[model samples]
Target: MTFSAFLWMTFGIFGTLAIFSFLYKDNPFYKFAEHLVVGVSAGYFVIILWHNGLTPNLFQRLADGDWYFLFLNSSKPWYLIPAILGAMMWTRFSAQYAWLSRWPMAMYIGIATGIAVPLEMANRINKQLFAMMEPIDFANFFGTQGFDLLDPTSGLSQLIVFVGAMCALIYFYFSKAHEGVFGRVATVGIYTLMIGFGASFGYTVMARISLFINRIQAIEAWRATGFDESNPEYHGGFPAVFWVILLGVVAYAIVEIYQHRNRPPQSEEPSA
Candidate 1:
């Protein structure tokens, strides 16, 4: 294999094994992997923000005025206002002048909220209400073709959705006391919510499992091919790095067992 590919593969295998070692016990390997991930992610974000965000969006725009159609220009000196506001955020690091940072933060929050609220209302709330307001067509229920209750996207499914949503909303209506029929409907709502949560959890677990399987498949492919683009079917079996890590873990476990066996026990102290 090429030197660069081999080096990358080694690092990948070692990082994966180190992370998985946490299942055995909290150890230096797990800590190292965790810290490495955090550090790398933070560093990468900083680099991306500098190169993609700060440079092109702010500094370059200020330096070189943007002219559109040779008649309209937008990159005026006023562009420095946002840059100044962004710089004001760093004032939070100062002990005495930390309050100065709040101006920029407040501006950011206000602008973001102003932009997001209308979009959220239109996309989420309005759309959900419209979906729940589906027409109850009796003709479709008793048409020439018999109704299929098992069809998930049928009128029956829509009715169930509407009922579930209304019940859940009623359960959250704290103004009215949940007694008699209200209590029963609220109980059904709670069960519906629990089923929804369980399904969501199962989906999340399956997604994670799929990701894990994909990574394993990639590793197995690399092991079989030896990461050598020159030789498509090298048939190297497992990488040497994987074997080294496996042996190291086994050795560490053996040493830990030996240490636990030979170590002296603590004597009990007298009760006060």
Candidate 2:
């Protein structure tokens, strides 16, 4: 295959192996592989900034004598604000002017928190709220059985799930005590939440198994043939990146399990 294909093939093989190395234990090899993934991700983000911000808006403008774009917008030249803030971050390196750096840092954090709150709510509320309103059908995942939830078509499942979601949401409401309808509902919600979580955990395990199978496919197909992201020709045509993610998660899981297993057992001494 082509060099690019060869590169992906190499990544799929070793990356998969490096990830699986953690199965034995949380070794340096797995840590190296995991860190490599993170480093690559951070590097990729830098590349994106360079391509989107530097290449066009910064460097191109400087080259073309469009200083207005650098300092600010054509109308306002506000771009200078970000540049100034960026420069201010470096000030923290010194002892004296470190206080000057906090203005930008505070603004950055304040703006991020401002943006994130609304997005978090929309993600949790908008999607899940509707899900709460809708009927529950386990057969949706099975496809062929269609929407027939059960013989009785019990709304208890939906009620339980909805109550659980709502009650769990209420648990986060620190303003007041969970009383009245919320108190009763939230109690039910806790049980429903537990059941939902248990089912989800099972699903997650199955997904990991699927991922392992996919990684095997990627390695075998690409080893002889090639990895084609655009129009990959493989046994199952699975992307190598999926395997990387799966491996990373698995590695993290094993580490977590090992940590739990190795922790000193708690004493059950009688309380005074």
Best candidate, TM-score-wise? 1
Clash tally for model 2: 7
In model 1, what are the clashing residue pairs, if there are any? none
Residue 179 alpha-carbon offset, candidate 1, angstroms: 3.3
Give the runs in model 2 whose Cα sits over 4 Å from its true position.
3-8, 26-35, 61-76, 113-147, 150-158, 161-190, 223-272
Task: Give lDDT per model, in order.
Answer: 0.78, 0.71
Indicate the residue-level lDDT of 66 in model 2. Answer: 52
lDDT of 2 by residue, 143-229 (tens): 334443453334555655565677787766768777987677667767767877999999999999999999988776665454444
TM-score of 2: 0.56
Model 1: per-residue Cα lDDT over 1-272, one tens digit each? 56557657767867877888898898888899999999999999999999999988767766655445321254556767887898899999999989989999999999999999999999999998998998855555533357776554566767878898888888898887899999899888898888799999999999999988977986776666664545665535435655776788899889989999999986698657
